[model samples]
Target: MTTISALPLLDGTSIPALGLGVYKVDDTTARNSVTTALEAGYRLVDTASFYRNERGVGRALKDSGVLRDDVYVTTKLWNDAHGRGKTRRAFKDSVKRLNTAPDLYLIHWPCPARGLYAETWRALVELRDDGRVRSIGVSNFQRHHLETIIEDSGEVPVLNQIELHPYLQQRELRAFHAEHRIVTQAWSPLGRGAVLADETIVAIAAAHRVSPAQVILRWHLDLGVAVIPKSVTPDRIRANLDVNGFALTPDDHDRIAALDRGARVGSHPDEVK
Candidate 1:
């Protein structure tokens, strides 16, 4: 089994560097994928209330026999649940479905149009104070959105999950995160398969004798960014966790860095609402 690495959060908790994501998958697929991933040595699982598979993820965690403390489970509050009261209630509902408080709870989107994210951030701070969650963070938030919440609540998110890959490296926002001691995590880390066919990535994979996906994932790991690659296929699921053997070279980083085009596979933060 691969010895999965981890990244430490400002809140004093650490999350596995690479994990599995359940985005469009159904409950059955989520359960099976979580089971396979746990057995294959993955210690992190990222899901969201929007995914509607928290029950399945919880089932796998309960039956996998991997002690809950050893597994880092992260879930999120959906856009519709962006208010102090609604955020609190939405978190409880998610925990009820999962049968345990999540180690990390994230706001799924900024939904700036709704103008409730700052209020939601205050509620997350309250939840943290109440011991309802281990830590709180945000997803798909741009620098301005992060600033709004941080400035209003006087609490910085422990991590910011975004659509990041070689095609969209997010260097500017990442620098802001570094300034605030916030961890940057990648969603759609593979660029949703668009980055897999790049000649540069393919060449790196050929040189390393691994899949193009592995090369891309290894690149994110080398950059100290947390990544969650999603797949329902068992072979692919296990293969995604097998990137511990090799490291990316400096020349490889330069080649891959040249691939950035500011392309995005997911919705932009400002357009989500």
Candidate 2:
């Protein structure tokens, strides 16, 4: 089992640097995958109400025998659930489904078109204040969305989870996050298998005698970002966490940096709504 480290968030809390993501995983698969991850020493599990697997994830945690305080679980409110009343109610529903208060709650997306994200952010702050959640963050938020919410609510998100990978580096947005002390977390750290086939990443993996996925994950760690790579296969789930052996050189980073082509396998924030 690999022991992952933690990074401190701005809110005086810490999160496991690496975690399991159950984006498209079915409820039954989520239960098994989360159980596998926990047994492999993963202390963080990222899910969302949108994923529709909170019940399975919650059951895994309860059955895994891992103490509640030892795991850092995260869940998000979907786009349609954005608003003061809806956000609070959505959170309550998630807590009930999760069978525990989530350590971190996030605004799943900015959904700028709806014009309710700012109000939704305030509701998240309220949840944190009410002690319903330990930390609050956002996902897929562009710079303008972040600024708008911060300006409106006077509360900056503790983290921003985004579609980031070797192909879509989002350097500018990451810099902005650094300015605000918000941790940058990559949702699809592998570029949805796009980067796995790139010659640059493949060569690096060969050099380290590790799989392509490990090289990409190692690169993500080197970039000072959190990553949640999802997989239902037990072997891949275990392999994803076995990235602590080798280190990436400056040359490797530069090579991967050059591979950035502004490519995104996921939807843009502006187009989501």
Candidate 3:
């Protein structure tokens, strides 16, 4: 079995650094894909309520014959469920659909305009204290949002999931995460397949005798970011997990680092509300 290394969170919990992302995949596809990934030796699975496939993910988990404790599962609370009581209900619903307790729970977005995320954070904190979730974190949060959470609640999220790839380095936010002992989880780690065909990434892939996706995933690993790359195809899912064996050269790393243009394919946190 080829097991990738794990990343430790501020709470002393460790999560697999690479996982299968089930974002747009539907129920049937998500179930089959997740089953295949588990059978292929993947121990981490990322899904969310917004993805609308937690039930399928749960079915796959049961079908895979993998123990609940052995697999690290993560799910998120959607933007609309940002208040304390609503977040509590949302967690219960997600857990019911997943059919297992989540190892890490995350806020899907900041949603500052709604002005409910702070209370949601408190509910997450309470969940952590109540032992339903092993760890809690946020997604698509900038440095300012992180500061607000820390300032208001006197608690720091264990991880921050963001749209990160070679093209959007997010250096400052990553630095802030590091300083605060928060793990940086990359959600569109391959730039949603946009940059995989780039000449630079292609050349790096050619030089390494790997796919461009592999090269980009390697860059994420080298930068110490946890990545979740979603794929319905069996081969692509396997290839995404087969990035642990190679190393990217210093120059290659620098070249990819230079590709940053701050390009964001997703909505900004402040605007998402």
How far off is model 1, as Cα RMSD? 0.7
Q: Quick one: ranking by lDDT, best first?
A: 1, 2, 3
Q: How do the residues 165-259 of candidate 3 rate in per-residue lDDT, one tens digit apiece?
A: 98899999999999999999999888888999999999999999999999999899999999999999999989989987789999998899889
Where does model 2 exceed 4 Å of error?
none
> TM-score of predicted model 2?
0.99
Off by over 4 Å in 3: none
Give the Å error, residue 170, model 1: 0.4
For candidate 2, which ten residues in a row score worst on lDDT? 1-10
Tens-digit lDDT string for candidate 1 (1-273): 899888999999899999999999888889999999999999999999999999999999999999999999999999999999999899999999998889999999999999999999999999999988989999999999999988997899999999999999999999999999899999999998999999999999999999999999999999999999999999999999999888889999999999999999889899888
Every candidate's lDDT? 0.94, 0.93, 0.92
Better of 2 and 3 by lDDT: 2
- Give per-model CA RMSD: 0.7, 0.7, 0.8
lDDT of 3 at 200: 94
For residues 149-215, what per-residue lDDT tens digits would candidate 2 score against the true structure?
9999899999999999999999999999999999999999998898899999999899989999999
Backbone clashes counted, model 3: 0
